[model samples]
Target: MRTRATVAAVSGALALSALAVPAAQADDSAASYPDVAKVREATSVRAEGEPYALNVSFSNVKIAKAVKVGTTGRVSTAVTYTLTHGTDVNIKAADFVTDAFIYRGSDLRPDHRLFGDKPAKCTATSATTADCKGTIEVYPAAHELLNTDAGTWRAAAEATAFNGQDPAGETFDISKVGYKTQANRGTTLVQRASKLTVDASPEPVKKGKPITVTGKLSRANWDRGTYNGYVEQPVKLQFRKKDGDTYTTLKTVKTNATGNLKTTVTATEDGYFRFTFAGTTTTPAATPAGDYVDVR
Candidate 1:
């Protein structure tokens, strides 16, 4: 959904602001929406519509990686928080509930909501304060789900309190009751996975004959649940002699539109041939097992 760019300033080392959600909704694709700006500090945030006064503070927000590429890799982060109730209210363990989630867009208006909401463990630090901890898991498919483009995203926290010990207990209209929302502006990056493979033919070739080495270069395509070719990327062809442990680069080759690699080398002795790839910002480096060739 599209959000209006109204900035709200929060007090203290932590910063939390609300972005107004307009009636309009933006397309799911990251290409369709503008990148959300990064928030450097933790901001204070207040939940709307709750009759009781509550304060949610976020701190020590640790994101596993600034950029994550594939399904094989996950966007992970741990967040810590303290919840304090007003003088009139008292909270204990399990009396209040909190959830942690990641969002892209503005504070109030998010174009994409990722890493489904999971509960945070809250422990009582005092009669009115609770210290809570939780995590966010974003996989490669998450990128596809958000239609995320390579860029930075935001993190948010939400909390709910029951009028009594049990939320399901009959007392007030559960549907009508509102919860508190606390958000911190930290950025995490998402990218694609890069992969490579190699195979050498004519395992027992006569010495001095040409040996053909073939390989493919590909990247994770979450949309397809398969790896697609990463065309035009440079790959290094290396060889290790049977008597030696060190591998020496023979030549540099580039992938074609289909990410295929084929080259020929003269057979001198029993050795192993392999391909290596240098990764990019949006992709992680990957290498397959070496192909062995036996020469007589």
Candidate 2:
């Protein structure tokens, strides 16, 4: 009887141990799992002569592992984009290129590039869409490549419409259409490093006083070593008194190596002044143009 009782106790202990093994293994697996999520593209559109507006959303967002990365445990998310002409204009979709870049600290890195397959026909009744998609794969070594201690990441999408085969020659239209990413684990997703805007301030220059108006055309991701893809052109600056008034030619100055323009305007009289910055690749309507300052 004693031997049977000992045998029974040992058997019960073994069975309990077998049941606990899987639970222990499950806890370990859960601890080792990495955080994964899906991302989407947000878009904004502006008419040629209208205030900038956004009709942003997402479509066909999918998440999976990147087979090229060679890590089955790693994962990536891909999102597709579509474009259409809201007006009657003949535009080639192939003339545009989509870019995807990753931000690490103050440095922005180009991760992917996609060119349009063919020219899109835009007519009064014509509408078109293009697949602008990107993927971010999560790997064990991804942190090393990105070099972020907080494990935070940021991304942006831009469309550049070209007129010629030269990538850097003439740009007809450029706009930032989309930006998205996962919840950043850091203080802030990398801030927009490059921004191009027209500025006209401290106006009412006395005639011959050399009214200095500085217009900034700045960029953040330009690789300093490779000149950040800098191009020189004679940008024209036009000044006007009112929104509907005809613009008076101020000066045409050449962009420096860094794409900055500083000009001095001698005000003939005290009146409202507006300025426009026109790049070589800018269209008459799409270029940066806005009211500068009101002369009192």
Candidate 3:
């Protein structure tokens, strides 16, 4: 008979003291840090059992096309895999753990730590086969990735089989035979971020008089966690009246160095003026809030 189970992971707790202590009253010595032994145990990766014995393999891996980040929000990618063990072995789904990670640069290390790995949910299809899926999360604001996380990234999948069943003994050995690791050298891109802003001079303007509209275009600079001008790029100037539900494109203006914008239009009615940017392969599109102008 077959049984289903979900392994639960132990949750770690963090403690903080609310009471303020003077610098002189506190222990300033290096001994104040956590014990070296506990730190090593928590940070170090455990050794794996021999893979040849487990005969573990992966197939049918699917990684998302791209990941995007901007001021508005962030994007995550889905990764799936098929896990198979040795012919005679019958491994339960709950006895295995899987993970999917996104890495940057040629070293293929998670050095940037730009993205976080998520645990996989695996279901046993047969005695030797299981299907697993997981996601990699990208955060622009929290991680300060901005445009920096853009470009090609490496995706990897890894799984491990414990010696015993779920909620079992804690002393089992972790080694090669207990683990399987595989990766796809194929690349996925993270698009750059785009931004736009608009304003109209003279809050109240005379009817039929010339009103100047101005704005700027910028994109995230990954290295700096800030935005910089996107020069020589054409942007659309749009307008929508108070009662109108849709905005109509009035004209197109190209950005100059430093991503500055300037244009003029005759005041016809009270409405909003805004700027829109058409994104490129490296950058994602963005539209800023409208600047209201009152006409007398």
Candidate 4:
């Protein structure tokens, strides 16, 4: 199994440097702050004979910026498996599916759902002959909650044969993949900005203010393509009045492939406001309070 560079080594250096500087100096520094640490690490399980060993590695894991409200950034990992026995083995792609399950605590039960799908296969030999290696990319759904009260999370990978064929089964446990301590420095701002402004007509909205929220999602180091994945699905803008207990759904909109949206909403109050954007494949991103101002 091939091992790529670990995220901790890369981000850790940045974090240490950020911590070494004076508080005031650090505040002025342009270095990007890491919202989540690469705490949970896992190595792929290697199996012998019938049961193949699969190894997975993750990279570029970090926290989403404040502008990334309702959305969470993720790390990409590659899963590799080696088949020892040359004996003809017919394995369906789906059978080798790999899933990522997150837990709030050390206990595995009541695991919080993250992401799941079939592993991507890269075969060097013929489709049905000899040895094969499969790979897949897994992203955490609730990446925004990584370093919060939700506790540390551990990831486990399970692979099975096409059918129930159990010629020989072996499971190798890995430290990097299992359970580990997590750090929560609170929400790390990936993008620097003041507020999100919404333009609407009709002076003050008495009953409801019809407005549009327009903005472009951008990242300094990350490319636009990576950010677009979060906004590809249908999204809803959730709103609430100042000092309100619960939020109400204002309007729904879909982000184009470029991660841009001009969502429409009906303002309900004349006070501080926030916007919660929800999507299917990605976690929801929210605007900071005071981002919206209402005059009613």
Which candidate ranks first by TM-score, i.e. highest? 1
The count of backbone overlaps in candidate 1 is 7
lDDT of 3 at 170: 58
Off by over 4 Å in 1: 1-53, 66-92, 123-151, 162-185, 243-246
Which pairs clash in model 2?
93-120, 194-220
Clash numbers, per candidate: 7, 2, 8, 15
CA lDDT for candidate 2: 0.32
Q: Candidate order by TM-score, highest to lowest?
A: 1, 3, 4, 2
User: Local distance difference test, per candidate?
Assistant: 0.57, 0.32, 0.59, 0.33
Candidate 3 local lDDT, 78-188, one digit each (tens): 877787777654444334445555555443224332322335666778877888776666655554453545677676655544444221235423332244555563456
lDDT of 3 at 54: 48
- Model 3: residues >4 Å from true position, as ranges? 1-50, 53-66, 70-95, 103-115, 124-133, 138-149, 152-156, 162-188
Would you estimate the TM-scores of all the predictions?
Answer: 0.62, 0.30, 0.61, 0.31
Estimate the Cα RMSD of every predicted model relative to the unseen true structure. Answer: 10.7, 24.6, 11.8, 18.5
Better of 1 and 2 by TM-score: 1
Better of 3 and 4 by TM-score: 3
- Model 4: runs farther than 4 Å from truth? 1-209, 216-231, 266-268, 279-290
lDDT tens string, model 4, 1-296? 11122332433212211221123222332211111111121211122222223332222223223223223344433333333222343333222222222323333332232222223233334443323232222232433233232223333333233232211224322221221222221222323111222333444555565655665442221222233323354445556666777666666666567656676556666543334443212232444443445556
TM-score of 3: 0.61
* Shift in Å, residue 142, candidate 4: 24
